[model samples]
Target chain A: GESVGLHLPTLSVQEGDNSIINCAYSNSASDYFIWYKQESGKGPQFIIDIRSNMDKRQGQRVTVLLNKTVKHLSLQIAATQPGDSAVYFCAENRDGATNKLIFGTGTLLAVQP
Target chain B: EAGVTQFPSHSVIEKGQTVTLRCDPISGHDNLYWYRRVMGKEIKFLLHFVKESKQDESGMPNNRFLAERTGGTYSTLKVQPAELEDSGVYFCASSQLTGSNTEAFFGQGTRLTVV
Candidate 1:
């Protein structure tokens, strides 16, 4: 089955440093992608999203870059804070599947203050 | 505005027992979805509801799981004769529209443990 995957299972970064999480999708028909942040004992919260038509999108301290040619996406966070420590997941919406978002194995971000 | 809400923050029951989980989506949101995350797996979609009608249930695991949205408002998921594999966090989400362009608001989730 075609699925999305992450490059790193865990990431550790200094509080004031930047962080990047990467994801790759095997389905080229996916047209939309989203990044979600899940804290301990909580459901995932939407952070940012990017469509296949666009290469990059930014929101607050986060930026999502999409590479259609390679079917890769990355999320960049600036000046990581303690609150940024969580499991980050990247999801993709299949081209024909409306309202269905397939999630990838997540990257656990650990920010050390 | 209130986000999606799920009832019974946690539950622990013996195998072969039955459990029911509830969800109340944001007001006026016609799209509701059910998803579950096992101990080490990614969240997987269980089903989707468009108002009172079931738009998609292809992801449902088996006949032991049943979901219903009676009035197009709140929804309930019932697991009969629950097995140990049924233990996980069940999350409910709602969106105003049914598409990738809109965002889905998630609930805190109900943690079910079948002992």
Candidate 2:
């Protein structure tokens, strides 16, 4: 079955440093991708998203880069904070399949202050 | 505005028992979705509702699980004769039918433990 997966299970970083989480998806028909952050005891929250037509999209402190050639995507958070510690999941929106977001296994980001 | 909200933050039920989880999506949002994450696994989609009609339920695990969204408002998921494998965090989300903002708003989730 075609699925989305994360490159790392966990990543640790200093509070002031930048953090990057990677994901690879197998479904070639997917046209949209999103990044979600889930803290303990909470559901996944929307972080950022990118469309296939674009290569990069930037949010407040976050940036999403899409590499269609490699079927890869990444989320970069600048000046990571302790509050940024959470599990980050990359999801692809399968349009033909009802536009449901297919999520990766997620990468746990631990930011130490 | 209020975001997606799920009822019963936690539940612990014995095997063979039945449990029902609820979700109330944001007002006027016609799209609702149910997803669950078993321990150590990725969040998997269970079903999706477009208003009162079910758009897709291909992700449903089995006949033991049933979901309904009556009146195109709140939705419910009932697990009958629950098994230990049914234990997990059930999350509900909502979004618009079509728009540039394709992001889905998620609830805190209901933690179900089948003991």
Tens-digit lDDT track of model 2 for A1-111? 111343448899999999999999998778989999999888899998899999999999999999999999999999999999989999888863466878999999999
Calculate each model's fnat, 2 decimals.
Answer: 0.48, 0.45
What RMSD does each model have against the real structure?
Answer: 4.0, 4.0
Q: Candidate 1: where are CA atoms >4 Å away?
A: A1-8, A95-97
Q: Go through the candidates in order and give each one's C-alpha lDDT.
A: 0.89, 0.89
Chain A TM-score of prediction number 1:
0.90
What lDDT does candidate 2 reach at residue A44?
Answer: 94
Clashes of 2: 0
Give one digit per residue, the lDDT tens place, for model 1 in B55-88: 8898899999999999999999999989999988
- For candidate 1 chain B, which ten residues in a row score worst on lDDT? B96-105
lDDT of 2 by residue, B1-115 (tens): 9889999999999999999999999999999999998874888988999999999898999999999999999999999989999988899999876444477899999999899
DockQ of each: 0.41, 0.40
